[model samples]
Target: MNRINAHNLACPIDGALLVCHDKQLRCEHGHSFDIARQGYVNLLPVQHKRSRQPGDSKEMVAARARFLNSGLYEPLASRLARITSALVPENRKTSLMDAGCGEGYYSDTVFKYLEDRGASSGLSFIGLDISKPAILEAAKRNRQITWLVGTNRQPPVTPASIDIILCVFGFQSFEGFRHILKPGGRLVLVEPGPDHLKELREVIYSEVKKSRPQDLTPVMETGFSLVDEQSFQYKTGEISKHIIADLLLMTPHFYRTNKAGREAAAHLEVLDLTVDIVFRTLEFQNP
Candidate 1:
């Protein structure tokens, strides 16, 4: 949080600059947001919320945190950091935003990697998620990360203040991303591939549909051109029943699964699964 200055933040309502002092963020228009006891700030205005509780629930957040802590996705995290670090230009300070950052796992990993490479002084890390529990959990992992319970549709960040935006297995707000990124800034996107957890799907569902191919056309329409993309696959060796249950809980399928599917996953003894993912780099180009 120390690396994020007041200049980097904006009032969610009026888009005015915010000044942080005494754990409170205030704008010139008299809008004030208090930093939580957990060190995260809530910038999600009620008007922007579609439900009483938007985004991942507390249970989902906990499941993801627990699963990620097991380091099953460390390869994806490392690749993300490597790709992001390469996209950020050298010899200058850079601001990075992790849009829909879940539990700060990816952001924290990337920040640590950058710092180890002697880029800490020149990098600013901001992690935003609509879920308060997720942001609170994220803040606990690294106090230096600027954690915010904010909507990605309208992030609480100044226009053109960010150099790199990361949208990993989360929502992609093209306009919001473009508004906050400087011209030529990059967006590193990660999405699940067809075989991503194929074994789990097979075990849980009677008919496991093949994953569809991603169309970059939508991204291109948002004033971004694809720069680079890489697909990654790794084996989980032999996973335990506990991990199987955790994996089910961590995915969206958990909500849609039937009682039988749930029981099958819960009763699994051992399963070998493949972790398949794709990373895409898109550079913003103003028309």
Candidate 2:
């Protein structure tokens, strides 16, 4: 069943340790966050929220759920699981946090992969996102993970405690990550490569500029050194209009594109896409 490592969580308001009490998370400073009926927790304090709604909207989360559940991205998920499994300690308890885990597709898939390999015992999985809608959707995928609605700038996980942090195409707070990750802990990032969804970009943008996926030099200077990097790429034969729409909705391009670009996409009966992803692992080191 799903369980939470409440022992590692902190109160967003006071930065005090939080524990599960009476189905709520309470800290010593009297700060309490409620665990929703869906079994996820809302740890994002109102003060920390940038707007009335901070992260992805409900419609975006729904589209993300639909696209992910369709298994078109299963190869990516499988590669992530394989990479994560290699980093897990064999005999010790470990904690993994999926920062900005949208609807829990990757986390859930990784959990099942580890479980199938008999490597899931004594592991705590946390799925965190700024979007309540995303966390709400994630909580339904697997009860084994602790899903929280919280911002990355101030993640509630305790300092120097997390074993691994996995972020996929999300905004990151490197300072926050450095604070929470243990020495020698790994940070895995999955970023889009230069040609990732180029076809889609061609349809939606007046001009497309393809560049490096990311530069880790700044991150390396911040106490994290690159450990490994791998490129994963694939092409789909043809996807239907409905799937294409769902894909567009699940990405930021939907909001960035003009109406004419969107209408052009809508009229396409089918389109093939190139999925280029870079999987990088960086290790946090003590100063």
Candidate 3:
């Protein structure tokens, strides 16, 4: 694994500043973390861990990997890459951090886009997740980028070190994101729109709760300025039973689906799923 500048790291043990010496990251208080041979580091302290295994289960990870590899979400990835690259300046070497990168699908796609455009050499990608297994799997696929097992509450990266941050259909820690982003750094958030997967939702639950779409005013209040927004809707042609099962496992709806709903999905002949993907780009504001 490549050794990152310790100056860009913080002590997960005490939240103190970290210093790098001889390929090791050490805190001012003498706490130390070692870089792994695979070119990544573990910043998650044991005390902060609530479980022996954190984050998505192995089964969920496998299901997600399989579903994503099928290229069902390739169009979404392409849009993300296009928007993110447009926001970043071409002259500067950029660093992108995916706060909840699961299985590295989107991050890998974005990195490949930069490479294909001859812009990858100046860019560094980091995928961070609370799930150790997910990070481990991501490391195997992209050796050039960094992978860390950590939480969004206290991102392991040093303050003001990131140029672009991505939060894609995952958790978001607005305060943590603001702390790590450089001045004028960009943050891209991808969320499921109101009409997202309505077909699946209708089948999974007895009563579909209709709530107003999320308001971005609160997000902007947290020291970010929204720059651009776009919405895309597409129908995923009739899907098979096996694909339905994988989709169930890959989303939170699995647990919320009623017994009747599951039975319906199981017996259904085909599913024509519709997705409304929303993307928002925000920039960090000066304090």
Pick by lDDT: which candidate is best? 2
lDDT of 2 by residue, 111-184 (tens): 99999988888788999999989998899999988999998899998889899999999877888899999999
Q: Where is the poorest 10-residue window by lDDT in model 3?
A: 1-10
> Judged by lDDT against the true structure, how good is candidate 3?
0.82
- Better lDDT candidate (1, 3): 1
Candidate 3 residue lDDT tens string, 106-126:
988898888888787777678
Better of 2 and 3 by TM-score: 2
What's the distance in Å from true for residue 117, model 2? 1.1
What would the TM-scores of all predictions be? Answer: 0.96, 0.97, 0.91
Give the Cα-based TM-score of candidate 3 against the true structure: 0.91
For every candidate structure, what is the RMSD over all alpha carbons to the true structure, in angstroms? 1.5, 1.2, 2.3
lDDT of 1 by residue, 207-272 (tens): 998774478898798789998989899998897888788779878889878989999898899998
For each candidate, the alpha-carbon lDDT, in order, equals: 0.86, 0.90, 0.82
Q: Candidate 2, TM-score vs. the true structure?
A: 0.97
Query: Judged by TM-score relative to the true structure, which candidate is superior, 1 or 2?
Result: 2
Ranking of candidates on lDDT, top first: 2, 1, 3
Could you tally the backbone clashes for each prediction? Answer: 1, 2, 1
